[model samples]
Target: MSGKTISELTNEELLDKRKKAKNANIISAVLIGFFVGIAVFSAIKKGLGFFTFFPLIFVFMLMRNQSEAKELDKEIKSRNLHF
Candidate 1:
């Protein structure tokens, strides 16, 4: 568990959290893509081009991923290490 209240973790711990978050993002994308593909294909079979859920979901997830990375970057840089 990362008992780091977002303001107490060191650079290495922040980096590790970023890595885990990124991995989770990748997994989410893969699973969502699979399910979305199935849904889109089923819709297409019915002559319907009125579907845009997957893209929206992907963008949302990607944004969350980037946000997490940025937060970690900000926290790590705020330390002002001088070694």
Candidate 2:
């Protein structure tokens, strides 16, 4: 990540940052799926516990990442740039 904000980044930097964000979002999604699977399995075997609730945090992060991606898309569009 750069010190500059999204609005301040040059087109190249913006594109790079968007790529990183997409990768991060993909990773987050994978983790969320994994955590949800663990939560479900844990719940079935041990009843409600820490594992069951752990996925919530990842879900929140995933949502935030998605929002960030949307913001990046908006910025790109505002600049009349295509991806």
lDDT string, candidate 2, 1-73, tens digits: 4677789988988888788988998888788888888888999999998978888777777776588788889
Q: Evaluated with TM-score, which candidate comes out highest?
A: 2
Off by over 4 Å in 1: 1-3, 46-67, 77-83
lDDT of 2 at 63: 75
Cα lDDT, model 1, residue 72: 65
Could you tell me the lDDT of residue 15 within candidate 2? 87
Candidate 2 residue runs with Cα over 4 Å from true position: none
Q: Tens digits of per-residue lDDT for model 1 on 1-83?
A: 45656677766666677678778778877867776776677577754444545455665665565666566667767776322
